[model samples]
Target: MNKRMVLILKHLLAVDDPVQSEHLAKLIQVTSRTIRSDIKELGEFLSKHGASIEPVRSRGYELKITNDRSFRTLLEQLFLSNEPHDPHSPDYRKLYLIRRLLLADNYVKLEDLADELYISKSTIQNDFKEVKLMLQTYGIAVDKRPNYGVRLSGDEVRMRFCMSEFIMNHSEKKQDEGLTSGSRIIHSEEMTLIRGVILEQIQNYGVMLSDVAFSNLTIHIAIACKRIREGNQVAMLSEDVKNFRDAEEFQAAQHIVGLIEKELQLTFPENEVAYIAMHLSGNKWFSGIEGQQAQDIGPERLLERRIYELGKEMLTEIDHDLNLNISLDSELLIGICLHLKPALNRVKYGMNIRNPMLDHIKTNYPLAFQAGVIGAKLLESKLNVNIPEAEMGYLAIHIGAAMERQHLNTRAKRCIVVCTSGVGSARLLHYKLKSKFGNRLEVAGTTEYYKLPHVPLHNIDFVVSTVPIPEKLSVPVVVVQTLLGGGDMDHIENLLAGERKYIFNYIREDLVFLRQNFRTKEEVISFLGKKMHASMLIRSSEGFIGLVLERENAAPTAYGNLVAIPHPIIPQSRCTVWAICTLKQPIDWAGKPVQFICLLSIDKNGDEPPSIMYKHLIEIVDHPEIVQQLLKCETYEEFARIILKHNLY
Candidate 1:
C-alpha cells in the first residue's frame, strides 16, 4: 500500500465509528474529493486483501475486516516490504536510521541515507539531530569521519543496549505484520538455540518472565551475540558488578554465556557475563512460588533493604511532589521495591527493555507516567545512572498498576439519569449507562426532571438528562440525546475518567488574568507569583518562582495545546487554590508553546484527595478549545462562563 492508503487506514483504525470524508480530508490535509476517491480505491484494495470500507450516506466510511488472518498478512506485507517509509514522520525516520545504522558494518554516508529514503541530504541531516539525542541517552554517539560517513560508537554494553532497543522495536513492527525481521541479525537455528538456552537457564534458576519479557531477553542476547562476534565487548566497572559476581543469578548468567560461547565459537569478556547476570538480577521477572518461599525462609538481605529504601525515597518524592498520598500503600511499596531490583541493574549497565505498552501507558495514564519520571529520576540519582524513556515506561506500568490498586477504594461518582418522558425511558437510560460505564459510573437510579428536587444532591455526583434541566442545580448536569448515542457515551466516559472534578472550587475570580501581554513563561509565572505574594498567600515572589522552576525541572507542566499548569514542586500554601494568567499569544514554555498558565497550589494539610485538586486541571490541560476560550476571556465572568459550559465541576 502507498503512503496515502496507509494514512487512511491509520485514521480508520483509530475509531469504530464511521468517520466523515470531510473530517478525514481535514486530518489528511487533502480535498474532500481526493479523500472520497482515495477511500474508493482503498476499499477495492482492502476487498482484495481482507477488509473493506463500508460507506454510509451521511456518516462517510467505516472499515470492516472480513478475515483477520488475511488482513494481518496484508498489513504485514504492506508494512514490512522493502519500501520507502514515511520520512515526514519523526518516529519512522529515527527508527529507520537506528535499524540501518546498527545493521551497517561500514560508515553510512548522508547521501546514501538521503537517496535511500528519497529525501534531501539536508532533511536526512536534520533527522540525525534527533538520532544523536536518542543515541546520547543510551551512551551511544555518532562518529563522523569529516568526509567519509557517520557510524555509531559507544561502550559495547551500551551499543548492544541501543541495538536491542532498535532491533526489538523493528521486530515488534514486523511481528505485527505476521513476519520476522531478524534473520540478518541472527540465524533462525542459532536464535532458537540461544532462546532455548536462556529459557532453560531461567527455568532452572526458577525465574518467571512474561512472554514479552522473555522475547526481550532473547532479542538482547541475539544482538549481543552479533555485536560480540564483531569483536565488541560490553564493559562494566568491577565495583558496580560486584553483587552479580557471587550470586546464583551470576552462575546462571555464566552457564548461559558459556553455552552460547560454545555454540557460537566466540569468547566473551567476564564483564559481559556479569552484564548478563545483571539482566537476571535486575529484571523485574517474578521468581515463581519456590523463589518466594526461599526468600521468605530467610530474613531480608542488606541489598533488599537498600532497594526498599530507595523505592521508599522515590515514592516519598512522588508524594511530596504530586501529593498522591500513595507512599504508604504496602502493595505499591512492595511493587516498586520488587521492580527496582532489576531496574537498578538496567540503569547501571545501560540496558534497555522494550516496553511495548509505553505509548499506550503515556497516553492513557499521563499522571502516572510523570510520577514514573520522578521515580526514575530518584533512581538515577541514587544509582548514578541515566533512566531511559523505555525504562521510565516500565516504571510507569508499576506505578500505574499501583495507582489503579489505590483507586479500587475510590467511590465511583454517583450519578442519576433524568428521563422525564416516562418510567420506561428513565429505566432504559439507567440500564444503558450502567452497561456502558460499568464500574466507572454508579447509576444512583433514574429521576424524573419534575422530581429532581426530591433527589439528594448531597449524595449525587451529576445528573445526565434526556431533556434539558433549565434550573442550575447543586451538582453538574450533562444533557444528552434520549437514545444515549456514541457521542453521548464518549462525553459521559470523559467525565467518568476525570471523576467530574470540581474545577470551580480551586479557581478564584481575583486571580484570573486574561489576555495579558506576557511573552514568556517566566513573565507569566512572575505575574502569578506577584499576585500570590500581594495577597500574602506566599512569603516571596522569588521563592515562589524558584519553586515553580523546580517543579518544571521535575517535569514540564506544559501538556501541549498552548496550556500549562505550573505549580510549586511541593505544596507551599495553607489552602487549595489556583491563579490563572493568559498570554496575548502563545509563548515558548520549555520546548512547547503555552498561551494559558494555571498556577496550582494546594494546602499540604488539606483532606482533599489528590485527584480532586489536579485532575480537573489535567482536563483543562488536555482541552485546547477550553484553553482557547479561557484565553479569550477578558474578565473572570467570561472565564467562569467557559468552565460552567464545560460542566467539569
Candidate 2:
C-alpha cells in the first residue's frame, strides 16, 4: 500500500467510530474523491489481510478485523518492513534530502536530488522550505549557490551535532546498526570497535556513563573519525585545550583515541582529543555517591559548593511556586547537586544528550516535569545557558522520586466525627471508620453538632459528619449515616488515598468552547487568552498570551492523544481555571496533531499543591478514548458530563 493508505489505516485503527471522508481528506490534504478511491483500494488490500473497511451510510468508513492472527501478521509485515527509504512519503523524502545534504562533501545540485527522488524541481523546492526551517534550529543553514546548488553550512561542532541527531539517531533505524546514510560515516563493525575502546578506557579510568551518554559519546567519536578522514577537524582555543589536558578525563580520551588510531589507521588532532575529553567530563556520573557529602566527590571544592548552592536555590523556587513542600529533602538536594555537575558541563559546551524517558516523564509525572521546567529556567538565568528539554526530563525524574518519597512519608488522614444523634452515635461512627480504614484513618475526636463549632480543625484533613453541615468550614465535610455504609467508607477512603479533586471543579462552563475552527496553535491560544480577559479571569490578555508563548518556545505543550495543554510559564491568574477549546479539525501543535486544547491557569495565591490538578489532567492525556469523546462534544453540558463521567481520580 502507498503512504496515504497506510496513514488512513493507522487513523482508522486509532479511533472507535467511523471517520468521515472529509476528515480523512483534510488530514491527508487530498480531495474527497481521492480519499474515496484510496479507501476502496485500501479495503481490497485489507480484505486479503484479514481486515476490511466498511462504509457506514451518512457517517464514514470503519475498519473491521476478520481474523486477529492474520491481521496481526499483516500489521507487523507492513510496519516492520526492511525498506531503506520511502521516496513516496514527503516526510521520508525530506529526511532523505537532509541526510544527503549533511553527508555531501560539496554543494549538491538540486536537479540531481530531484532526479534521485523522481520528483519535479518544484516539489523539491517546496520541501526545502521545511528542511531549511528544521536545520535552522541546530544553527545549521542551507548554503545556496546560484549554479552550484545547496549544501549544509554551519560551525563544525554544530554540523557534527546535526549529524548525530539526523543520521546516527534516526528513529527508523536501530541504534546498534547504521542507517544507509550513517553507514557512509561509520559501519556497524566500526561502531562496535569504537564502543569497545570507550568501554575499556572508561573502565580503566573508573568513570561511569549511563547507557544513553555512552551511545552519544560513541556516535560523537565516530563522527569525529569520519570528519577527520575527510580533512575536516574541530578547532579549540589554546587555553581550553590546556585546561582539558589538566583534567583526568583527558588521559582516558588519549588512551581511547590512541587505540582507535591503531585500529582505523587514522590520526586524530589534539583538538579532537580535547573534544572527546569534554564529552567524557560532561557525561560522567558519580556512581555510588548517593548520601555521600559533596565535598568528597570532586577535587574542586569551590565548584561543588557552587553546585550545591544552585541546587538549594532551584529546590526553593520549586517549593515556593508549586507548594510541594520538598525543599527540605536532603537526599533530593544531594541528587540534584550531583546531576547538575555534569548537566552544567553539557549545557555550557552545547552538547545535546538524549533522554529516552522524556515522554514517559512528561506523561506520568507532569507535576514533577513542571517543577523541572521551573528549575531549568532558574538554571538558565543563573548559569547563562539554555537547558534542553531532555536535561529537564532528567531533572524531573529526581524531583518525581522526591515527590514519591514525600508521599510515602506522609501521615494518615486525620478527621473529627460530628454527629447530631449525640456522643454515642459519634463514637460509633468513629470506631467504624477506624475499623474499616485501619491506620490509614486517624480519628482525632468526636463532638456533638452544636459543640462542633468549638472543635479545633486546624490539624484535621476533613470532617466526618453524621448530619449535613450547612455552614461552610475550612475542611471538607463528608456526611454519612450513623451506621457507616460501604459507599460512605469508599468515599472516605478515596478522600484519604486519592488527593485528586473532581476534574470539573477547575473547569468553568463559560470557558469551554466546542467545535472551534482554529487553523493554527497561535489562533487557538489567542482566542482563549482573549476570552479569559473578556471574562475578567486574567489581568492582561497580551501579557498572559506572551507568557504562554514563551513556555511554548521553551517546549511545546502538546502531549499526544489529540491533546495540547497550553499554560503560562508560571501561575498567571488569581485562581486556577481551565479554558478548554475543542477544534473542529486538528491543528499541527509543534509536530503533534492536536484537536483538544486545554488552556490551564494555575491559582497564583492558592496554598494547595498543583500536583493533584496535574493528576487529573494526566488522566485525560493518558486516555485517547476520553479525548475523542471530549472532541465530539458540541455543547458545554455534553463536555461537562463526559468529563465528570470519566473522572479517573
Candidate 3:
C-alpha cells in the first residue's frame, strides 16, 4: 500500500524469526514508533491476503501465511503490480522512467510519461533532467524533437550498454530474489538455450564463472543478439581486437560466437568475437580460466604471470593503504589476478560492466571496498585506464570475498544436512550451500530426517534441514527451503556468532578526546594524530596523518549520521585504539556535516582482524542518536556510559 509497508512486508518475507520493531527501524533508518504504526497498517493489508502479523511481545512480529496461494498472489500484486514501481516515491518513479526510456522503441512524450507516472508534466520534465544526467554517464544524450517527443541518442553500443543496465538491471544469478530486476526481450526458452550454450563452451574451454558473472554474460549475449537482429553491431578498434585474438579466451569466444550465430541464425563480426572475449576476460570467468589453467599446466602464461605480479602489487598497495592482513591470502591473490585480467580488457575496449552490488558492498564493507578502490587505483596507474565506479564495484567483490575468506579459513563452521527432499533435491541444496558459503562452510554430510540420527554431531557444528526438527538438539537447527534460497547464508552467519567476537576493547578512555572545537576535518585529524604521537601510541604524527589523508583521498570515511570514522591507510600505531574527537559543532567532513570523529589506529601486531572492530564501530555509527549523545558528552565516563549501554562486547 505504502512504501514503508512494502519494505516491512519484504523484510517479514525475508526472515523466519520474528523481526524486532527496533531492528526494522534501524534497517530503514526510522524510529520504532514509525515501524509500529506501519506494522499495524500493514497487518490490515495482509489480512485481506490470507497473511497476518503474529506479534510476539518483547520480541517483535512474524508473518504467518494462512493460504499460501493467496499470499503468493498478494506478493505478486504488491511487487509486480502494473504500476511498475511505487509512483509515490521519487526513486521508484525514476527507476520506472529509466525502464521506459531504455525499452522505448520510439520517442517518448513528456505528457505521456507524466500520465504513465500519474504526475504532472512539470514533474516529468524535472525528473527527465535527473535522467539525462544519469544517462550521460553511459555517454547517452536526450535528443528532443519538436512534436516528435524525446529519444535517447548515442553510439549504438553505448545505447545498448545503457539499456542493459536498466533493462535487466543485473538480476541476481538466482531466478527471482535479486534486489534489481531485468527485462526479457525474447522468449524464456531462447534465453535458456543461450545460457546453456555459453555454459557448455565455458566447460569445454576448461574455465569457470561465478554465478553473477555467468548471469551477466547471458544477459549481455541476449542483448547483443537482439541488437544484431536490428542491424546494430559493436564496432571496436582493430588493434585491440587483434590483441584479444592472442588470448585463449579469444579462441573460446570465437567458438561461443559460432555456436550462438548458428543457433540464432545470425553472424558475428570479427570484432564481435573480440567483444565476446572482452566479456569473458572482464568477469569472474577470466579468473575461472586462470584457476583451470593453473591446475592443468606446470607454468603460468606470460599474461598470467603479469596478472599475478600486477595483482601482488595491487594487494601490496591495498595492504599499505588499509593496513589489513589480506595480502597474505593465497586465494585472494589468485582471485585478484583473475578479476584484473578481464578488467584490464574492459579498460582497453572502453567497455563498462555495471556492478549491481556496488552500493550494497560499499555500505556493508566500507574499509574493504575502499581498499578495492585503492586496488583499482593501482591498476589504473599501470594500465593507464580510467576505471569507472562500476568496475571498482566489481573489484570490491573480489577483494571483499578474499577478506571474507580469511575469516572463513579461520572461523568458518562445519555443518550436516538433514533433508526430507529427494536425492536430486538434496544434491542441489548441497551445491547451493557451497556456492553461498564457499570455503566458509564445510558440509559434513547430508542425510534424510530418519537417518539424521546416524549423522555425527560432535564433528558437525550445526544442522541445515529441509524439515523442522522439534526435538531439542545440542547444536542449532537451521530450517531452510529445499531451494537453499537467498537469505540462508545470513541466517547461517548469525548461527556462527560464537566463532567471532567483537573487539570492543579497542576503544579506551586514554584514546578518546571530547568536545574539541575543531573547524575542519584536517584539524580534527591533525589534533588526534598529534595526541597519539605525544602519548607514544603512534611513532610519528605527520606520517600517521599523511596515511589517514591518503585514505580519505581514496574514499570518504564519513559514513552517514554525524559520525566520521577516519583511520590511517595502514597501521602506524603501536597498538589499536579509537582516537576520538567530538567537535564542539558540526564541521564539513568530505561533504557531510560531522560532529563526531572516530580515528581508529590498529596495532601492527594485534590479535584482532581489521574488519572485526570496524564492524563493531559501524553498529554504533548506525545510531545517529547515540553519536549525538556522545557529542553531548564532555567526560570519558559519560562517553563510556553511553557506549557500554550498547553491550557490544
Candidate 4:
C-alpha cells in the first residue's frame, strides 16, 4: 500500500471529529514534530489550489465543500481514480491516503484510519502537504480554522480545474519521470476555467475516464493554448500525437504553433519561448519515449476539413441572411469557445459536451436562440433531410460545440462467464457472475465450456473460468477455484480497470430502437414503430403461442423469490404491439415470482418478419422468473436490473 494512502486511511479511520496533533501522532504511531510538518504541507497545498484545508490548534483537519455542481463532481471523480504505485515511489503513500480519505465519507475517524493504515500521525500530517500542493497547481485554495478543522474554498470552476490538473499531472509523475508537458504561455487562471468546464461536463453525464485519456486531454488543451497564442489560426501540422512512440509526434506538438504561423497569417514575438521549447520537448509526450512509427493522421487537418464543410454549407444556405464568413485554424479564440460550450450547456441544457472544444467554422458565431433556429433550418434544408427541426437545433449545438470542445470517449468493461457444464452450477454461476459485476460491467453471456469454443460472445472483452477448458479461449481469462466471494469482485475490478482504456465512440448510434427514447423501454419501442415506420407483428392462428392456466384457481404468479412474470400468449392478429408493462404494484405470477409482465407479439403473414424477434423473446420467456422482475422495472435505464438480476439478456 502507498504511504500516503495509508496515512489518509489512518486519519479517516482514527480521527473521528477533531483532535490535537499530539493525540493524532500517538494514534498514528508518529512523533509530534513529524505531524506538524505534515500539517504544514497540507495547508500549503490547500492554499495554492484555492481550496482550504483548515487545522484546529487543539483539533485536527476538516474538509469544507460548497455548491456549483461542476466542482463538486470533479472532486468526486478525482477521489475515485486509484492508480497502482511502487511502495518506494515518492508521495505514493499520500496518493493512496487521498483515495481512502475522500471515499471514507465521514464514516471512520482519524484514529481508526491510523490503525488501519499502520502509519504515524506525523506521517499522515505530512501527506496533507502533498495534497495541498497538488490542489494549488489547479488554483484551489485551502484554509485552516483555529479549532474547527480544514476546509476547501474556491468557486466551482477553480476547484474543478485544480482537481483535474492535480489528478492528471501529479498522479503519473511518480512513475513516468521527465514526461511532463512543462509550463506554457496560457495563463493559469484561464486554464483553471477551461479545466473546470471540461471536468464538469464529463462528470455530469456519468462518463468514466481513464488516466491515459485524462493525460491526453491535458496535453491537447496545452497545445491548443500554444497555437492560440502564436496567432488565432487553425493549425495543420505533420506530426502525430497518438501512439507517442515517434519523436516526430513530440516535435509536431512542440512546434505546432510555429508550423502554422505562416498559414495562420500571424506575427510572433520573442520571449514567447514556451512555444519553441514545446517543439523541443516533443520527446516527452507522455509516459516514455518510443521509436515506433507514428500515425500519419493530423488532428489539425481533419478539424480544418470538418470546419470548411460546415462553413461552406452554412454560407451557401444563409449567405444571404447572416452573411457569415469563417476560416479554420487551430488557435486560442477557438479553444476558449470550446471551453465555453460545457459552461453554456450547464447554463442552457443542464449538461455539458464531453469534447473539450468543437471544430470551428464561421468566425463570429452567435449564441442566441435565433442563431439556433437559423442553423436548424440550414441543416434541415441541406444535410440529413429526414431529421426534425428541433433535432437539427440540438445537433447544431452539439456540432458547433463539438467543433470547439475537447471530447473523450467513455467505455464500459464487459466480461463473459464460462460454465463447465449446462446442467448443474451454470445457472448458479450465471447469477453469481452478474452479482459479481453489478453495473460497472457488461455480462455478455454464460455458456458451457463445451459450447464456449463456438459461442461468439459479442463484446466479450475478457473471460473468467472455474474449470480448465479443453480448447484455447480467444479473450483474456482469469482462472479461479470458485466463483463466489471476495475473489470475484477483485477479478472484476481488475478487468474493468484494463477495459477502461477502450471507449465506445458511437455508443447510441448502433442501436436502432433505443436511440430515440433513452429513458424508457416502452418509449423506445413505441418510437421505433411510430417514428421509424416499423410495425409490430402478432400471430393470428389458434394454435399460436398463448398463456395457459393449469388449475381452475390460477396460483399466484409470484414465483416466491420476489419474482413474477405475467403474459398472455394469444394468437397474433395484424402486426400489433406487445405491451411490456411494469406494474407500480407487485403482482403474483406463479408461487415464486415477483411482479413483471412481458407480452410477446408474433406477426401474422406479412413482409415484416417475427423470426428475428423470436430469438430475443425466447431469451426473455425462458426466464419467466426473470421477466417478473422486469414488471417492476419503470425505465430503460433499469434494463440493466432485469438483464443482470434476472440473467435474461
User: Which is better, 1 or 4, measured by lDDT?
Assistant: 1
TM-score, structure 1 vs. true: 0.70
Better of 2 and 4 by lDDT: 2
Each prediction's total of clashing residue pairs, residues at least 3 apart in sequence or on different chains, is 2, 0, 3, 121
Most accurate candidate by lDDT: 2
Q: Report the CA-based lDDT of candidate 4 relative to the real structure.
A: 0.40
Candidate 4 on 1-649: residue-level lDDT in tens?
3344335333533223443555435334457787767766754544444444466564455533333464345444344443434544545665544434322223434444455456776766676788778666445555655544455655433433333333334434332332224322344555555455435543543333455444444444544445445443322222322322243333333343353344444444322223232222321222221112111223233233443355445433432332222223223223223222222223221111132211111112222112334444444455443322233244345334533342122356676777675546656766776676666566676776667768775568887777766566677776655446676566666566542222221112112121121333223233322321223232222222222121101212222222222222222334423434444433333222223333333332322323223334445533323443454455566655456554322
Task: Pick out the ten consecutive residues of candidate 1 with the lowest summed lDDT.
Answer: 174-183
Sort every candidate by TM-score, greatest first. Answer: 2, 1, 3, 4
Top TM-score prediction, candidate number: 2
Sequence-dependent TM-score of model 4:
0.22
Give lDDT for model 2: 0.83
Higher-lDDT candidate among 2 and 3? 2
User: After superposition, which runs of candidate 3 have C-alpha atoms over 4 Å from their true positions?
Assistant: 6-39, 46-84, 170-184, 262-265, 284-303, 318-329, 354-371, 386-505, 508-564, 572-575, 581-597, 603-612, 618-635, 645-649
lDDT of each: 0.75, 0.83, 0.75, 0.40
Please write out the lDDT profile of model 2 over residues 1-649, one tens digit for every residue.
Answer: 8888887887788667787886677566678899999999999989998999999897788999999999999887666542333447777778778888888888989999998888999999999999999999888999999999999988888899889987776443533232243446788799899999999888877776878778889989999999999998888789879989988889889999999999999999899999999888886555334344543443244246788789989999988777888888877887788789888888877877777678778777878888899999999999888999999999999999999987878899999988888667777888888888898889999888898889888999999988899999999998999898887877887799655555556888889999999899999999999999988979999999999998888778888667889998888787888899998888899977888999999887755458778878888876655776787898988887887787564
Task: lDDT for model 1, please.
Answer: 0.75
- What alpha-carbon RMSD in Å does predicted model 3 have with respect to the real structure? 12.8
